[model samples]
Target: MQVPYLLDVLVSVLLLLGLFFLLTGTFGLLRLRDVYARMHATSKSTTFGVAGVVLASLLYLRYLGLSSGLKESLIVLFLFLTAPVGAHMIARAAYRAGVSLWQGGVVDDFKKWLDENR
Candidate 1:
């Protein structure tokens, strides 16, 4: 039996949204001026993009009567848990190494906090 049109449309939308996020992340990685900003773009967008793709796959598997939803959900959970922590560690490393922020960017709150605490 053929799949329903609504399922097809939903899958298409999810895939397209995921692809869009991935592409935007790639663009940001290339075009952004500072290490912190670039790291932010890459981690956040890639996490969302991969989650979307995994969600689409989960939905498709459910429609096909497959039992892989738990796997996909776990993958998304790991991504959500790790991406921000990874980004923060990288940014902190860059900061400790004396990587400067973008010229036009606003206040360096983290740096100020570090100064005040130390």
Candidate 2:
């Protein structure tokens, strides 16, 4: 009984962390200014949040003594593989759309490089 319950508890903790990252991502999207910042919020935090949730799902299935955890594990695999591509596309679009950074922001290496190349 205790062993089963402990696994449930672990799953719950992971789920909570997942939710925290999700909420954080949403909050960052709303609170931050500019397209670049919004992409930053949406891309990184949500990816990690989903990762946490997927890990929790795997544990939850394992705790249930299911015959396989492969399905749940696959969800995490899909997330890891796709999240970065989505972020890159978003960032690229924002750049082309001329979204500028906040005033006095340092490090315009990207712009500098583009200028030099063109």
lDDT scores in order: 0.91, 0.84
After superposition, the stretches of candidate 1 with alpha carbons farther than 4 Å from their true spots are 113-118
**Predicted candidate 2: what Cα RMSD to the true structure?**
2.3
Model 1, residue pairs in steric clash: none
Q: Which lDDT tens digits does candidate 2 get at residues 46-101?
A: 98899888888877667667637888778778888988898888889888889888
State how far residue 69 of model 2 sits from its true place (Å): 1.8
What TM-score, to 2 decimals, does candidate 1 have? 0.89
**Once superposed on the true structure, which residue ranges of model 2 sit more than 4 Å away at CA?**
1-3, 65-67
**Residues 1-118 of candidate 1: C-alpha lDDT, one tens digit per residue:** 5779999899889988998999999999999999988997899899989988998999888889886599999999999999989999999899999999999998878888988999
Positional deviation of 17 in candidate 2, in angstroms? 0.8
Clashes per model (N, Cα, C within 3 A): 0, 0
Clashing pairs in 2: none
TM-score of candidate 2 to 2 decimals:
0.83
